[model samples]
Target: MPTPPRVLTIAGSDSGGGAGIQADLKTMLALGVHGMSVIAAVTAQNSLGVQGYWELPPVAVRAQLDSVLSDIGTQAVKTGMLASTVLVETVAEVLADVTVPIIVDPVGVSKHGDSLLAPDALDAVRSVLLPLATVVTPNLWEVEQLTGIKVDEENRLRDAAEAVRALGPEWVLIKGGHLPGEPVDLLFDGTSEYRFAAARHDNRHTHGTGCTLASAIASHLALGSDVVEAVGRAKEYVTGAIEHGFPLGEGIGPVDHAWLQRR
Candidate 1:
């Protein structure tokens, strides 16, 4: 037996097991990486929506980061809903000096349109957290939230990417899934640009798509893929997962993380 590449997720926990830390860990396992978690918040969430959430104390978050990084350091890191200004700052401070690849998924709301992040915390995410990222993945709504730029058309994805790049991340991935037609995501690092397009599955059960994609990217990075390659592979994996998505609760369901294994 050999040790697998390790990836850590710093995020909220969704009780429903569809998104947040749950999805991150599942995606890591599917991608053949060991997944570790540092829970920043806990949400009473299900397929219907988020009822409420509680943020852990800053000391607890710091302790969790130290406990993981000090003993079993990870090869890559991925972040999701931090929920508050202090939590965002706490995570940013700890991840500042980490040399491994970092993936930032600026989760603003749930699949059912429930707000997950505090409005006051947006500045900290743009200033402190995003700059420490090796790559920042923001969907259309998040892009508009972080940088006042709304991407309504596929052609405007570059504009949104550039706006986010100015915030200091080495790479920016603008997810155009909200736009009409097939989903097209643009990846840019100031100079080089790459676009990944996937067939849109006509399924309404895409609850954890964002979390799954970001975690898959982190997993591939931990497994020695470059940023471009990692994003490409992640896009493919998520497309399959979306295609195989199954209904869970009464509301939206989750993408199948083990879609590959099922086949």
Candidate 2:
């Protein structure tokens, strides 16, 4: 009777199920959207750290995208962890024709501090992928990687946001989770800027936060929420997720995806 909101994640696979495609799908489901995935790489990772990764061929990635977009028709698309420059370009090219909000999570590293994006792929992301993004969600490290701006203080957040917007994304959300004090994130849409603040949860199990935030934004955008509202809602969701985050392994565990269920 009603059309379900369709969302797609073109990203890597997390064998640990804490982040990557696993987190994207979980976040989409929590926000009442139909989730789909196109795996770009398969990672051997756990809470301890990333052990190894092998990227899928460009043809396989394209085939997955074509199959999904041809049938389900996505309302929004989110991308993360394009492991190589070739994969980055391939994803950008395939999604160029899709008329949906694109949430790009420039995943540069894992929660345990292992590199995700290759050194050579940075330029590809900056030149090819960012221009097509509806919203670019970058964590503090990613912002530094993309723009060479170090975010040390609150005022520096604006600088980071401005630097990211210069690359062509309609909006940029520079996550300030690494900054000291309350959890604060900066959102800039060229003309306007918004700051979203949440209580800094003292939890270490925050593995999937970036993936969850991007997918949550995609879900909200598909539901017709504006950039500011979508980001605000996404931040609130992530905050709650972090507050109830649980320990899964010896190292940092994952934010509880079933947080809403607990509440």
Q: Pick the candidate with the highest lDDT.
A: 1
Q: What lDDT would each prediction earn against the true structure?
A: 0.96, 0.93
lDDT of 2 at 202: 82
lDDT of 2 by residue, 1-263 (tens): 79779999999999999999999999999888899999999999988999999999999999999999988889999999999999999999988999899999999999888999999999999999999999999998999999999998888999999999999999999999888888789999988999999998888899899999999999999988988899999999989999998998789899988899778
In candidate 1, which residue ranges exceed 4 Å CA deviation?
A: none
RMSD of each: 0.6, 0.8
lDDT, candidate 1, 85-173, per-residue tens = 99999999999989999999999999989999999999999999999999999999999999999889999999999999999999999
- Structural similarity to truth (TM-score) of each candidate: 0.99, 0.98
Whose TM-score is greatest here? 1
